[model samples]
Structures are given as structure tokens and as C-alpha cells.
Target: MTEPLFKQIAALIEDSIVDGTLGIDQRAPSTNELATFHRINPATARKGIALLIKNGVLYKRRGIGMFVSAQASAIIQERRVAAFAATYVAPLIDESILLGFSRTDIHALLDQVAESRGLYE
Candidate 1:
């Protein structure tokens, strides 16, 4: 399913935060700039920005512009981790159950995959 425009915009900003393209107290693109750059409606961009502000990922200066919150990256990371579990881990477990795989089997399989990818060290 396609994500909503506002959510996509929010995700974009979150990604920027995670990747260090945006840092704490750094100014964010203006709503108009986001709208123009993404070819989206200004209102949609504003709504996305508002979500960040509400979630404490961003704050506004009196007249300067929006800036990343001091803890924006941490906030974004927490949200993304929760979302990842919901979006991927839950479904993987459900599918494994439907396929008659035991929990041990799943763990072993994951371990094997991680070893192959050099991630089990």
C-alpha cells in the first residue's frame, strides 16, 4: 500500500535526521521549499512539518524558521524502530507460524542468515 503524502514527507525528514543530513538545531527546509522541491501542496508539507513539531522532532523559532529538536534523531530512531517491528517483524512471525515453523526454527534460520551476512559476530 502506498503511504500518505504527509507521512512520506515526515519519513523524508526523519531519514534526513538519521543520516545526519539534518542535525540538532539545524534549520529545516521551509514549508514552501519542501512543497516546491517535492512537487506537493504547501498545505500537505505544512501538515507533515506540524507532525514533527507535535512529536517533538522539530521546533520553530519566532521568525527564523523550523529547526531540528535537540533530541530529534533519537525521537526519530525510536519511532522507526517501533514502526519496523510492526511493519516487518510481526508479519514475518505470522508467516512463519502459518508455514508451521517453530520459534526455534525461526531463530536458527535468522542466526544462519546473520552469520552469512557477517552480522553474527
Candidate 2:
């Protein structure tokens, strides 16, 4: 199953931040703008934006829309690491163990894969 729409919306904003499409200290798109762009409800867009604000990835200006926080990129990177570990590493470890692979075996397999992908120097 896919993530909830709000989470997807939040991820989209975080992705923009990570990719430098939305720079820190820049005004974020309004809730209505996001709603229109994604064809989602205003409440859904608001919830997504609110999540970022609550997590210190964004800040709201009085009478103005939200702005990207100075720490937005770092916050998004931290979230991405946690998401990666949960979504990929945990499952991979579990499946590897189920397949009778030891910790060292898993490490070696991952190293081999990384080398094959030219990720290792």
C-alpha cells in the first residue's frame, strides 16, 4: 500500500528542499497553491505543511505563508535516513537472516553490491 496523501505531500516538499528547488529562507507555496497543484484538499495540504512546521522544517510568518527553515535541508536529510533504515535496511536484514545469512554475510553482500554499482572506491 502507498503512503497517506498527507505523508506523500510532505515528502514532496521535503524532496524539493533536498533537491534545492526550494531554498532555505524562501517562502513556501501556500496551502491553496499546493492543494491546486496536487489536486488535493486544502486541509490535506495544510496538514502536510503543518507537519513540516511542527518538525522545524518550516516556519510561518505572521499574516504570511510558510517559509523554509534554515535547518530544513538538515531536517529533511535526517528524516530521509530514518526512512531509509526503516523502509530498506530493516527489511533487508530481516530477509537476509531468514535466508540463513549471518551479519558478516550481509555486510559482504552489501559491499559486493555497492562495488558492483561503483559506489565503493
Candidate 3:
């Protein structure tokens, strides 16, 4: 609960969209459905849905319900990549440079770790 419940709700839905659990144009669970499932207030769930709508991750279908946007996965991926770079890569690079590590050193270190961890397919 480091973030607000509504934000957590939005992230949960975004995770599903990004992981292909929820495909493009798929109807997202309704506000009531989420609220019921999570035992939260409907208003809180609506706030989460509203945040997604504002971000274009989800779109309303008039009288129907909210659906995944065609670019939902791409949008989530782009945003997440930028966030990951800012939060992790940037700091790591700055620290590595301060510690006298060159760009090549960083690349070698990363590759070594990736190889050892079976991260490279």
C-alpha cells in the first residue's frame, strides 16, 4: 500500500494488459466488479478506472463498459521502460561513473551478470 489503493488498482489492470492477460478491445471488469472482488468502495474503483481513461489505457464503450485500448500494451510498455530507466539505470550509471567504471566496464559487468543468471535467451 505504498501507493494509494486506486493507483494499485490501476497498476493491477495495467499489469494484466501488458502481460497479454487482457487483450486489446477486451472489456475490463466493471467498477462494481473490481470493487466487489477487492472489497473496496466502488468510488475508489471508479477513480482507478478514471485514471486509466485519462491515460488512454482504457476507453469507454458508451453504454457498454470500459475496454482495453488498442495501444494499451504499448503505452504501458513505453511508460514502464522510461520509469525503469529513470529509477534504476540512471542511478546505476551515475554511480558506476563516479566509481571510475567506464561504459565498457558497465556493459561487461551487465553481460556477465546476465549470462550467469541465465537472463539472456
Tell me the TM-score of each prediction against the true structure: 0.86, 0.84, 0.92
Q: Candidate 2's residue-wise lDDT over 35-121, tens digit each?
A: 999999999999999999999999999898899999999988987899899999999988998899998999899899999999977
- Give the local distance difference test score of model 2: 0.92
- lDDT, candidate 3, 50-98, per-residue tens: 9999999999999999999998988889999999999999999999989
Task: Quantify all predictions' global Cα lDDT against the true fold.
Answer: 0.94, 0.92, 0.96
Task: Kindly report which residue pairs in candidate 2 clash with one another.
Answer: none
Q: Per-prediction count of colliding residue pairs?
A: 0, 0, 0
* Per-residue accuracy of model 1 over 17-84 as CA lDDT, tens digit each: 89999999999988999999999999999999999999999999979999999989888889889999
- Candidate 3 local accuracy as lDDT? 0.96
Q: What range of 10 consecutive residues in model 3 has the weakest lDDT sum?
A: 1-10
RMSD per prediction, one decimal?
Answer: 2.0, 2.1, 1.4
Best by lDDT: 3
